[model samples]
Target chain A: MELIVPILAAAVRSGTPILYATLGEIMTEKSGVLNLGLEGIMLIGAYVGFIVTYNTGSPFWGLVAAFFVGMAVNVVHAFLCISLKANQVICGLAMTMFGTGVSSLLGRGYVGETIAGLQAVALPGLSSFPVVGPVFFSQDVMVYISYLLVFVVWFLMYKTKFGLMIRAVGDSPLSAEAAGISVSAVRYASTLLGGGLVSLGGAYLTVVYSHMWVDLMTAGRGWIAVALVIFAIWNPLRAALGSYLFGGVEALQMRIQAGGTTVPAPLLMMLPYILTIAVLVVISVFKGRGRMLGAPSALGLPFYREERE
Target chain B: MRIKVEKRFYITKWQEVCIILASIVLAFSSGALVFHFLGVDPLEAYKMMIDGSLGDFYGVSETVAKTIPLIMCSLAVALSFTMVVWNIGAEGQFVLGALACTAFVRYLYVDNFVVMLACMGISALLAGGLWGAFAGFLKARWNVNEIITTLMMNYVAILLLQYFVYGSWRDPTSLGFPMTPLFPKSARLHQFFSTRVHSGIFFAVIIALILWIVVRKGVWGYEIRVSGQNPKAADYAGIRSTRNVILVMFLSGAIAGLAGMAEMAGLHRRLQPGFAVGYGYTAIIIAWLARLHPLAIIFVSFLFGALFVGGENLQIAMRLPLSSVQILQGLILFFLLGGEFFRNYRVSFISRKR
Candidate 1:
């Protein structure tokens, strides 16, 4: 009973980064552009976040810089995919390679450098509650932001006129175009904004989770987030559920490892990835034909305004 | 005047060559700019890269050695890519293959030269093929995304390799290094011309030729082409694409595994941490540049192999990181992808429909 609270609390903390990334990918996909470059964007964001915080001594600015720089890098993907109408998958893979290479090169000198990262701040009243408060409210600023972000995203995706347009563009760009929406504009907006949020996920890893820099530190968390996006069925609320579940498994793994279990660390490390595969299987099995129902109809397909059939 | 983008029909071979050349030139120019900012003279860096890879017989041979694994891995990836399976797990498959070969050689000591190599090779192929087939099975049965699954499995495979080499397999006598003891002389592959070059080159060449022939003339090749062109049509034609998916992935993985076995037996003679050098990832780039043609894979892999060796030289001669080569690679991919727009469509300014 006592262990559950800490595990949940740790789960929320661990899940926050993925939640942000999942949310970001949801928005991007909702607008019909699939950017598989989230892994690369996250790496750049982590590097920029770490370096900036180390230099300016302000983690907030570190995040802001990372976000914008991430958007700047995303511009290439946008240009190649949207403007050039190139293969989205290949472009995204290239973006990953580009981001990884650039970040590794730039971050070589800054390796192992520590910074005064974002600290935890518990809300007085909410934090005092037994289980929920500590797990949800009593955490660092990023965790708090992630919570607000979930609702904010849900609202934006479900309620707003812009949300309608984004989903409309994703579902059927031709109809959306006929109904007086600029398909390119909507895609560009979602892609850039979602890209910024994804960058924040990476920034959180450096500015909040760990205080020091390491190469390839994101360690497939970005990829895990990619899986989470699918598991969430593109819903922000479900994304929270999936992220927390993954986080709990991670926390439990660490707890078990800490308690001195006989299982090897490498084998333990495979748990999350294996869990991701298992979850995908379960989702596809249960969801059946509707497994990918929520996916944007125009996903991975380049929208060419001129090619009217 | 509004600009109109029109799809071009029947592009000339000259135009195709020019476009490919332009993409390369643009990529190199961007690479040079990166080198300039990194405080190295871009011109000198280019010269150094070329000379280091191709300057002498030794450099050429070294590049060939690196190219061996690259060719095999490229073919592995290209095979899956032909069916649009996106088997990015070749990295993991490669490491797993190497590990399986090591385990086989270690536990089952066979004195006969060819028999030992054959057993080790078969085990490696099975390990890698099964790893690939697992993803294929998931995709075939559950419609799972192979890209993410394959990519995720790579980390698991690499970690598994690390666990073995760093733990039980660590050599006891050699200053506690995280590698197995040297293989027996029979286990080591035959070298050529008193150099690091080995019979692996023949294996790579043979695989390339065999793949080329099979893809062009074999029954499975026709099925693969049909399925790739139109899955629905292929299905209607009674092509069991599900089986084909698993089969192609297995072969893809098996070839990648063979590359691992060759690297371990021919070059290193023992599994080490250095065995997981991003050849699988680099091979994807080769596959893309070669347009997934089996013969072209060999040529492209050789070029990339040169770039890798040159990167090593740059690391030694100048205090530059090898990641600079990675950056160049990224630029090439970006340019190549961007150039895809040109091949498919052409934009021209026609006076606004008046």
Candidate 2:
């Protein structure tokens, strides 16, 4: 029972951060931009949010600060890559570096410190349930928010006209532009919004999970989130499922390590990455070409508005 | 108001040098600004960095010591990039190469210096090339995305290293630290100078020059360039793009693997978990910023090496975070990439939509 509870708790905690990142990535990718800078942006967000929350003693302010910083970084990215039609990969990489560097430079003072963390908000009626109570009902607001965002994004992407336009823009700017839609604007908005959400996820890690600021604290979760985007076939809901599974695997590894299993920590830590590749290989084999997963038709191709189509 | 358009002449060689110099200055200044913000004098911090990296004989030796692996890694990425293979798995290749060379050093009993060097180098090359070829074969055969596959392989390589260090190769006397036993003296790379600068620098330079000649004057280089620039056109021109891509990836991975050997033999003398301080990943940025030009990589790589030394100094002297140095790197990449827009496209404002 003790082992089970800790594992369950670990899974929930681990999954939330990945859930935030994967969902955010799904949104940006839906609009035809592959923001590889999520890792860097998340680091920055985690730092900024932690600093703010520690200073103000309010989680809300911390979240706001993270959102603002994330949005600001996204603005730079959108301007250079989307508006200017520069290389998407390079721009994204730059964003990541910028976010990481800025965060580290500013966050130096906050190292080895703790802050006022978010309180777990138990759902009134749902919290009364037997086994599922702690698993689903009793959790911090960010955990519930991540779950809610998955559905919200799913509905927005699949069932709505706006979602269709976003998809269309990603598919072909020429067609979308001819249909009287602004491709650049939609891309910019989605990129920024996506960036903001990913940063919020980072902030949640610091403010809710660790209540501390540290260097490279996200520890490649950003890359895992990037891989999850592909693994889940760019679907926000599926991405959530993947995150949960990945979180469970990660949690299980930690539990076994804690249990004094002879396996090395590095090998245990590598489980998630190895599993990620395995899952990718299996999905590719079973699905026989995952083209229908809403992969942007013109993903990573820089759009030149003035070029003859 | 209509902005006047300026017509510019062809790009000059001098202009290229100027642009590089400007980039270095801008990147370093931005680095300094971070130090300034952290309550340290930027000038003094930079001085401290210089002092740490190359102010004295020992510092220069250490700087040269660090530069060899960097140059090799940069060359690895730069060479493959010419074929547009985008092999971002150099870090893994490096680790694999080190592992292979170390394995030879550990198990082998009789070894002359020359034979030992040849075996270690060959072992590294073979290991890295095989891994690189695996990624290439997947791309050619199944149409797998090389980026994702190569990246995934990196994790596999890292895990393999970690497993060995922590499991089979755990140093007996180190009190549970994840590292291997030290190599025999014969397996170690000979230092060129007393200051700790190893012969790896000479090897890297020679390799860079050879790559420059191959990319510039060789027929195979021509094929690689044609394919990288435009695959469809290369195919239409009767070039086997697939073979070239595979060949280049193999060569790239092999060179990166050699860098791993250099790190093990010249510096560390043993393998550990954090053996590579991200030299492979940083090489990607270096390759691109150098425009994937083999000759250009020499200057670009030295600049990066300086930044590494300088960044370390900034950390110690100014208490600036390590991430700030990475941020400067990102800014350089950003400006270079952003600069490419002007290189490739012209921006014009049309009348507002009525």
By DockQ, the best candidate is 1
DockQ of each: 0.71, 0.54
Q: Where does candidate 2 stray beyond 4 Å? A: A1-9, A286-293, B3-21, B38-40, B54-58, B175-178, B235-244, B347-354
Task: Summarize candidate 2's per-residue lDDT along B218-252 as a digit string, tens digits.
Answer: 99999998898888799999999778777888998
TM-score of chain B of each: 0.97, 0.90
For model 1, name the residue pairs that clash. Answer: none
Query: Could you tally the backbone clashes for each prediction?
Result: 0, 0
CAPRI classification of candidate 2: medium
Q: What's the TM-score of each model vs. the native?
A: 0.97, 0.92
Q: Candidate 2 chain A: worst 10 consecutive residues by lDDT?
A: A284-293
Please give the distance, in angstroms, between residue B309's alpha carbon in candidate 1 and its true position after superposition: 1.0
Residue-level lDDT of model 1, residues B72-172, one tens digit each, is: 99999999988888899889999988999899889997898989889989999999999999999888888888888898999899889888888889889
lDDT of each: 0.88, 0.81
